[model samples]
Target: MTTPRYKRILLKLSGEALMGDQGFGISPSMIKYVAREIRSITDIGCEVAVVVGGGNIFRGIAASSYNMDRASADHMGMLATVINSLALQDALEHSGVQTRVQTAISMHEVAEPYILRRAVRHLEKGRVVIFAAGTGNPYFTTDTAAVLRAQEIHAEMLMKATKVDGLYDSDPAINENAAFIKHISYMSVLERQLKVMDMTAISLAMDNDLPLVVFNLSDEGSMLRVVCGESVGSRIDNVTDGKNRVDRTAAVSESYH
Candidate 1:
């Protein structure tokens, strides 16, 4: 049996990751795949919490670019996140994983309001808690919401699930010679503006001393390997600020293969 490095973690999943090749709304197969991966870790006695984004359904910042009121756009984005959260909860339950959906904004009909004690209690009872609605406010990204919830729940670390394998010096999609980074420091991430996560999210994680792992979600068993402390992706921590960062050799690969 493989022991996990962190007993409890907050897994951040982007809504876009749920879209599959359709490039639009939710893909049932993709969501089920994600649910099964999450269950793999939970079955091994790991406490998991999730914070899902709303980009696939709606993007507040993108709407604001078209002169829409920022607040209204953001609110709509929050509702979109709720839709994804419910879908995720259903998938996890079907996979035999006990799950709960809690929203920052009160949506009593579907999910319980986000309460710190109740959320923690759910994790203690081996139930995965899905946090939706993004802080119950506008103009904040789900990335920030994930950090906040992780801190509130005292999660050991935050796992960011992306299509890419790990952080890179450049956008791997455009640059063929982009370098993959194996390890980085929080301060370095902010100073270099690596964009693995939003600045607000990075700063919060830095201040809280919470380590973050970024890895490819589409790859089979990647999440389980990460939880088990395998070197499957980039790890960002408080190591020496900027003196020692591991840079993988430049390689060419499709963004999602």
Candidate 2:
């Protein structure tokens, strides 16, 4: 058997990815597909922990921008994440993967309260852990929660699943001249104002020297490829090893696929 690159990893999935082609709400088929991909890695002895977002059902920031109280909106967003977490848990169990949902908020009826030791225990027992509720606080993105949980669990790296293949100098969908960055420094990401993640999350990961791999979740087997150390996404860390960014027009197909 080929050895995997990272024995354990934290995957950050935006709530939007759960929507599939739908404009809003979770898609059952989509959740099942994600569960299968996750199970595939676990079958190879790779431990997985996931932190999911809640933008599909509710986005606190967007609601607050419309005049709702920011804190209340964010709390509502947190509930949305809990919903996604439960759905994912059910799907994983159906796929025969042992799973646990630990939430920041105290919800004994649904999930266990977030406990660092227990969460680690679940992973050690070969069960996937799904972290929900976004730190159980307002004004924080799921990105930040993912980083925090990853550090607490001592995950080898954080995998940020997104709609795009990887980070680019510009929005690839809008800019034909965008550049594909295969490897980048965390400082460079913040300096360039890349939208890979929120500044707080990026800074937190940078301070702790946690490497992040941003890749497209829609592509089949993309997650497996990333865990295998294939060059499928833009990797951000403290060092670049003297690699130059490639123009998207020249390397988009080769690098992303």
- Candidate 1: RMSD to truth: 1.7
lDDT of 2 at 257: 16
Model 2, TM vs. native? 0.95
**Model 1: per-residue Cα lDDT over 56-170, one tens digit each:** 9999999999999999999999999999999999999999999999999998999999999999999999999999999999978999999999999999989999888889877
| Runs with alpha carbons beyond 4 Å of true place in candidate 1 | 250-257
What are the models' TM-scores? 0.96, 0.95
Worst lDDT run of 10 residues, candidate 1, spans 248-257
Compared with the true structure, what per-residue lDDT tens digits does model 2 show for residues 116-163?
999999999999999999999898899999999999999999999988
Q: After superposition, how far is residue 198 of candidate 2 from its true place, in Å?
A: 0.3
lDDT of 1 at 226: 90
- Candidate 1 clashes: the total is 0
Which whole-number lDDT from 0 to 100 does residue 52 have in model 1? 96
Q: Model 2: clashing residue pairs?
A: none
Top candidate, metric lDDT: 1
Q: Residue 178: error of model 1 in Å? A: 1.1
Worst 10 residues of 2 by lDDT: 248-257
